[model samples]
Target: MSAALVWFRRDLRDHDHAALYHALKAHTQVYCAFVFDRAILDALPSRRDRRVEFIHASLIELDAALRARGGGLIVRHADAREAIPPLALELGASAVYANHDYEPAALARDDAVRGALGAAGLAFHTFKDQVIFEKSEVLTGAGKPFSVFTPYRNAWRKALTPFHLKAYPVERYAAHLAAPPAASIPSLAELGFAPSNLAELKLPCGMRGARQLFDDFRQRIADYGRARDFPAVKGVSYLSIHLRFGTISIRELARFAQEQANEGAEVWLNELIWRDFYQQVLWYRPDVVTQSFRSEYDAVQWEEGEAAERLFAAWCEARTGYPIVDAAMRQLNQTGWMHNRLRMVVASFLTKDLGIHWLRGERYFADTLNDYDLAANNGGWQWAASTGCDAQPWFRIFNPVTQSQRFDAQGRFIRRYLPELADLPDKLIHEPWLMSAIDQSAYRCTLGRDYPKPIVDHAAARERTLARFKAVRPTGD
Candidate 1:
């Protein structure tokens, strides 16, 4: 009957989906399915994970969307490497279709699935749906993959055409979609998870939620350039979670950014290009998953022993005594999202100020962020550590007080998470430790009692960090 199975992964939405579109176009009967892969879910540190909850909520919407179009999602909760091939065979499908995933672990899973499907005489097909430009799509003048972002972004801009931004017209072949089953999706408990605060958080789920956020952000996109850096303002698009999960398409976002022709939109578009940049890096140098991108940076001696462990615990618990860093960590713990600006600040504080390793912070973010994409998160931590392509300079440390004053001045964002420091005047909020003992008594806040004192002085730490990096700096530069 020329049947094909469409396997949904990170791209959860129904419309304009690359694999679904292609599957429908080529088959007389196309069935869609989503597996809550146990390999990923079981490895999570907490069962109350917001990302898992987000995916669960999104699948409900996706299932409904497909049902409305004469198809529904075949939901399964199992190891995908063991589940997909048999399911495709049971459905009498000759091929399995999916979108590409670039993470080395994900790539390995795909390879396993492909091999199993091939042994069963079923072809496995994958398409590029996540990014507009993938590995080798945009390159240097000599056709080498770009290590630096600016030149790559310029090339990405020059390579952009209307075709790349065009959506896949899935509606064209919807008639071929097979009818859906009449079963409801599994509950959170059924999936071995507890209810998360995902609904309470402003981070919406599913295609409808994605559209809502995008529509609102569209109205304010002109202000994005000046507004994104400030955590207190609603200046940036809160659509990152949507972008990470493919509830919204990259083409749609990029297309709008290109049309705006404004500085704000252009800057946002560059950020989108950065997604592709990291993706290609992961594709080319999977070794970066462990080793530093610049091998020289790997030679530096990171702080070790009980003291380093204590520092990491404080950073994780939001007890760093640096207001901005602690506030940012608080935000990440309470909610699964952090502001991009704060992400950089916290990463800098963790690696540079505390002199801990970047991998530890990267792993922490991997467990925490609702929109955690491997490529972006890894690239970001590496950038902050100054050990990645086009990373921040190793000597350039972020002063936690300065970052707080600059981005959260007036203490609006800091107050939101660290309410204990709420009573301090805006002038004293960024560095409350600066207050005299009498002033602390007056404000009803104490330095060491109410709030922990700064664990390491930023100035002293900066000098030590410089010396550590200097020991490993390449001879020429």
Candidate 2:
């Protein structure tokens, strides 16, 4: 009776799970397990990390679901490199299965785990589950990886088929799920983590939560393009965190998007394609994990220490005196998320306006965002900072005030997050300090005191950023 271990990593759900489905089909008996992986956790700055809390809750839900199928998830709080091989030997499993993780660190860790398992005489198998198209799949006509998105997206759509959207029929092999000797899930405190403050935030957890959110988004899918920019509106699908962990199926989401490819669905699908493009970028150009995507951009000088710190603190704390920028930061600090447009706004402010290194802002977002993925987060930061392949030109720096006025015409999103700016009239809220003395007095706010004045004048910073780019830019062009 050959037994197989299904090692759950980011793919936390039971339905349509590629690795689990393969394991159940090939083996007579199967066991499932999840490791808390201290190698990853100890690096995290906070004990109350919301991503941890979300994973913990998802694991509990997974354990419960497995129990209903006459099996249980063996939860452990150790490094995967040490935990998996020994557990495979102990259970006499012939093989172990898992989904691919494209992050450089994860790829290295998986290699080590596979080597260890092979040394212990166990087969290690991996499947591509997280993405529809990956490294070299949707390439240029010349067979090179695409650095541009439009051609890549077109190639992706042309290559996608029903097979790509087919759900793995895990339920068909449910009988193979072994009735493992029962083990209990460790409590958050027991595993060296405390309950997160996210409890009050009521973030949806697990497969059930993902489904509920997806259903709600379907009703408003048409308005996604228009609404996703507004922080106060439910324009964007909050499915990013779910997509990050694979608590939800990418196939289902993509299939749904394909079915609805109206103006809204098409916009949403483009975002998903961007998600895949970034993953493939990370897979093919793993150096992007630490360095700029466009090497030439690295020559640009950055302001560091006291000045950078002051600007970063203002950006993070949502006191940048630019309402849209402030609102975006407040959303991230308060809820661990931000609208996509605001991500661009804040990143431009950091890289172009403050003249700080893009890496610093990228790391800050990594620390704060619940939906942070290595590839997408890094790609976004690089794109905003003009340091990535196909990045926005450095000279085209966003005017934060104009961005606010254009996106939040009524200042509804800004007022919701920055209460101090709430009383300012619609026209003046975006740049309250720019208002006349009479308007400023009526609003009961002053630039230097009530809100910090703009850290750097935009026009001056724009010229400075442009000149810096020119210094390193290609001499011929």
Candidate 3:
């Protein structure tokens, strides 16, 4: 009986998984495994990281799911490159299969693992599971990679076919799952990581958790475009972490959106496309991980040291004094997620209003956000700071006040996150400082004491931002 191994990476689910499907098809006895991946985990800042807890919870669920099918996930506590090939050799598997991971470090790790497997006369196969369109699949007519989103999105939509959205019926092939009944998944502490405070975080964790969130979002998806920007409303699908880890299939979500594209289904569908778009951007241009996509925008000088530290501390602690920005930051600090619109508002506030570096904000998000993916986070940061390919026009800065008024009109979002501002009248919630001193006293809040004064004057900052943008912009235009 020929045996094979499926090395699970970001794609954690058993259903509709490309690598699992391929492995089952090619081999009669299939061993499944997941590595705790110390190479990645050790580098993370916190042991109590929510993402780690989320993955640990998901893995527990996955092991049970596999056990029901007469198999179980052989969870490990080593670096993948070191662990996978050795396991394949011990099991005498002909090949190891996994889904693609486009991050540079992941790619390097995979290459090393492949080499080790090759030395042991084992083949390594990988399939695309995390994204709909990857690498250069949706290039422009000129055969170059797309920098602009709309054209790329259109091309992506056009390229979609039945085959792309088809789910791999893993259940039909379940009999082949290796019956390693004696193999048991280790407890989280055995992996040298402590249990996190994530149970209190209220985030959905596994396949079942992902589905529950999806079902709720499906009902509200039609209003996603209208409601996603408003933080107080439960308008956006909170499936980002699920999608990031592959607890849910991209095909399933894309198919759901594609089928309902008419009555504003396109709005939700567009977000899915944005996910793919950023992935492809990262795949083709890995340099975007650190440097600017458009090189010239890198010339814009950034504030540094104590000044930046203070500004960043203010931004992170929700003390930026721009009510919307503060509220959004509070949401992120408390919940590990931020609404997309506020992501834009706060990012613009940091880079343009405060003249801070995009990378600083990007790093902060990377550290804080549970749903953070390298591509999406980087793409968002670059777009806000006007340093990415087809990024927002440098001159078109977002005014924080107008943005707040437009998106969170009733101060519902602000009040929810900024409880200090909760008692203020709706008229004063967006800009608490504008209220008279008597009103401020009545509201029981004072700028610079109870809250913060605006870090930078919007008008003065906007002029400075405009001048800075013009300084580095293409001379002819």
Candidate 4:
């Protein structure tokens, strides 16, 4: 009987998994394995990374799930390129199956693994599972990848069929799941990582965790459109981390959104479409990871030297003296999660207000965010910087105070993250430094001592930003 090995990557769950289902159907014996690739782990800056902890927890659940199905995952802790081929040889597997990973580094790694497996007389097969439509599956009428989002989203919707959203029934071939020798899933310490605040934050992990979050989100999804923008409110799915790790399937989320048919569901579905859009963008233009999508924008000058370093440090530490910006940064530092509106606000503040390079912020987010997907994070930073496809106009700078006033009008979100400014009235909460000395005394909030004064004048920064971006503007206007 033929044997196949299913290498688990981002798609971690057992159900509705494309590679697993395909392997089960085609091979008489199907084996599952996961590699804690050192190539990725060793590059991480922190040993207390939440993503690593979350993955560790998810893998435990995955192992248990596979065991219940009369099989167990072969866990490894080597570079995937070296680990996968040898494992296939040891198992005498004829094929190695896995889901697609579109990032350039991952693509290169997959190519190497494929080559090694081919040389060893094993077929390497990959399926599109992480996204609903990937890699030119939904393209423009001219058969080119669409750079614009709205049209691409429209095309994605048009191309959607029942078959596209259908779940793979791996259980139909459960008999083929081979019972492998028991292996212990590694702990955080075993992986040379320390415990993170992920447990304290109480964000769920694994398929069970994904289900819990989705069940809660389903009830509130009808209000998502209006409530999602407010950081104080519980409106968003909180499933982004799940999506990034593939603990939950995209098809499951999209199908639910479509069936709901409310304004909130539709808006949320639009978000899923945006995820697809960014994926395809990365697939088509890999250079965007480092360079601006529009080459002209690369000419824009950013702040540098000691002053720029100080500004970035302030932004990272939530001491920029702008309540919303500080609050957002603090949220990221404390929880590894930031509200979507605040993400845009802080990104614009970084690239436009501070005159810092977007790549710097992108790298910071990649290091910090629990849901950090390279394409989405890069696309978002570049979009905020007005250097990406279909980006916001450079002239449209976000006013931090106004954004705070609008989104967190009552100062609920700001107070949650920046308690130093909590006693300030709503009028001054968005701009705590604006309060008079007498008012500050009355509120028990001192600008320099309790919090900080605005690092730079907003009006002055606006003019400087306008001038800075003008250098990269198209010749005519």
Candidate 5:
């Protein structure tokens, strides 16, 4: 081909990028472009979106990197499906390349783009870049998609090879990069978004940011296994947003994990594998986006009507009366992120204790989380609700107090987010309702006064949840 266009979607980096590498290697003149799709941006619930701000900052870096290497990014704010083909035609490119996006909506968008490209006598090529293994790359002995995580993890590990971990060597074909026509990258305001707390949260953006986070985490990976569960501790890598945006290469991180022999690295590697596992699940069963993975569990009725609305609002607004749950929700509300362990705790409390539908909580997370990945979020919510493949057993519901007492033993995380309960003794912090009037007054915290009472009795809620699931439980294996 004389010329080719590379469309940047989730894969934003210049180096080790599959589509970019292919475009540069295959053609004499290569152009790169990213469209801030209106179809997506116009539907966002808020103007001050951290995700958009992060992307804007990242694009500025990406444009700089590309410019330094004899290429530049072409930016546009339009419907991508309506823009990509015409942009390719206007550039007189023979082909358009992009990394695969497995989300159903993305797949549909890509399909539309492909049809348009084909009609214009142009080729559209996509490669697996975001994930290590995709589609049927890893499967069960019966040639079926592995629904359970353990066996899938084992299979994913066994299937690993050096080739899968190797970079695409994009710099090798830097000669093919064509300089862009004069045009500057768009500002966040120009793109119809306001700046969010992403910078105040100290989250670096783009390739440099990803590198910063990975380097810091490399030093702490050895301790991840033991310390990751405590929300008060900085035990986990904050590279999730980086990974979500493709600012870092999956191959690079997985290779680093594979080289490390420590238990913490092993656990972290397992998390990466889980990421791949969820991606594959999303690919094979896009229906999981709307329905339960195990359909039988769908029969279990969730809380409804005004009472359900009140409970859900309490959960979202961080006044659930459970210190840990409220604290977790508060963290999510204030920061665009939540601790991994707290995600499970709060999700369990919403679905099990309050009996609200998982989708309600799932949609809330989708809106708020900076790393709001559909596959992982849906998989997690379903797991919490005991409605997913290899999910937590319905009867084995989480007791909010016990989880709080264990995970936040000193109530450090709780106090950080719920300052009203800051003076409560650690023993009583997890359950302030247990404090007597004198103790509550002495602590400067009064139940239903300083803080709301527990929204639902854990024991009672647990029994009700068990009964709900039991009604739909398939008899005998």
Candidate 6:
């Protein structure tokens, strides 16, 4: 009987899975596997990374789900390029199946795996699972990949059909899910990692967790448009980590949003489209992984040496003295997640306000965020830095104080993360440094000692950032 091996990567779910569906349909017997690829893991600076913990937890659920369906995930801790070929050979499989990964390194690894599998006379099949549309699927009238989001979003909506939102019914061929010998999944200690505060954070893991968050979000989705901007309010869908790890299918989420057809639903659906747009950007311009998308902006100089390092360190540790930015950083440090509005606010503050490079901020986010994806993270940092295609204009800089007063208007979100400012009035919470010595003593928090003083003067930084961008910006830009 012909056999197939299904390789699970970011997409961890059992139902509505594209590769598993195709593999089970074409082969009489099929086995599933997941690799804790060392190539990716070894380079991580922290073994206690929450993302690793989250993935490990999700995999346990994935394994149990597959076991119920007469199959089990063959978990491994080797380089995927080396592990997959031998596993396929051992299982006597004629083919290997997986979902697409658009990151440059991932693409390179896939190419190597394909070559190895081809040499062994086995087929390596991949399908689009994580995204609704991939690569150049949704392009312009001239067949060029879209660099701007709005036009791309319009074209994406125009091209959407029921076919695109359809889920792959993997259960239909579950009879072909061949049972494998019981393989032990390595513990966190065995994998050279330590425990994290994931459980304490109460982040749901695996398919079940994703569903729980989704169900809650659906109820408040009508208010999502207005409430999402307010960090203290639970207005946003906390499904990003699930989406990043593929515990939930994009098709499922997009379909629900499309069906809702409310104002909030439309706005939420646009965010998903933005995700697809960023993925396509990465596919078309792989150089964006290391360099700016708009090449000319590469010449823009960023602050460096001792002063910049101090500023960056302050930013990372949530001691930047800007309440909103500090609270956002603290939230990420503590929970491995941050509010979407705060993400923009912090990124803008990092690049435009601090006169620091966007790549620095991007790297920090990549290292810190639990839901970090290369495409979206890179796109966001570039947009804030004004160095990407169709990015925010260079002249526009975010005022961190204004953002704090606007979003965390009552400073409730700020006070949640910055307890030292809890006693300060809402009017002064956004700018504690402006408070008089008597007021600071009354509040029992002193700037530069208890919390921190504003790192940079916003107006001065704004002028400097404008001049810095103008140095590299093309004529008439």
Candidate 4 lDDT tens digits, 1-477: 999999999988999999999999999999999999999999999999999999999999998898899888888888999999999998889999999999999999999999999999899999999899999799888999999999998989999998989999988998899876667777788889999999899989999999999999999999999999999999899999999999999999999998896899999999999999999999999999999999888888899999999999999999899999999999999999999999999999998899999999999999999999999999999999999998999899999999999999999999989898888899999988779989989999888898988888888999999999897799774
> lDDT values of the candidates?
0.92, 0.89, 0.89, 0.93, 0.93, 0.94
lDDT of 6 by residue, 85-183 (tens): 999999999999999999999999999999999999999999999899999899899999998999999999999999999999999999899887668
Please give the lDDT score at residue 445 for candidate 6: 94
Task: Report the C-alpha displacement of residue 446, candidate 2, in angstroms.
Answer: 2.9
TM-score of each: 0.99, 0.98, 0.97, 0.99, 0.99, 0.99
Off by over 4 Å in 5: none
Clashing pairs in 5: none
- Flag the better candidate by lDDT, 1 or 2: 1
Native-to-model Cα distance after best TM-score fit, residue 289 in candidate 5, in Å: 0.5
Candidate 1 on 1-477: residue-level lDDT in tens? 799999999899988899999999999999998899999999999989998889888999998888899898898899999999999998999999999999999999999999999999999999999999998999898989999999999999999999999999999999889864555678889989998887787667899999999999999999999999999899989888998889999999999999997899999999999999999998999988887999899998999999999999999999999989888999999998899999999999999989999999999999999889999998999999999999998989999999899898899998998998989999999988889989898888898889999999999999999999999999875
The top-ranked prediction according to lDDT is 6
Name the lDDT of candidate 1. 0.92
**Shift of residue 198 alpha carbon in model 1, Å:** 1.4
The 10 consecutive residues of candidate 2 with the worst lDDT sum are 225-234
What lDDT tens digits, residue by residue, belong to model 3 across residues 51-119? 888888999899889889977898888888899999988888999999999989899999999999999
RMSD to the true structure for each prediction, in A, is 0.9, 1.3, 1.4, 0.9, 0.9, 0.7
- Candidate 2: list runs displaced more than 4 Å: none
Residue 12 of model 2 has an lDDT of 91
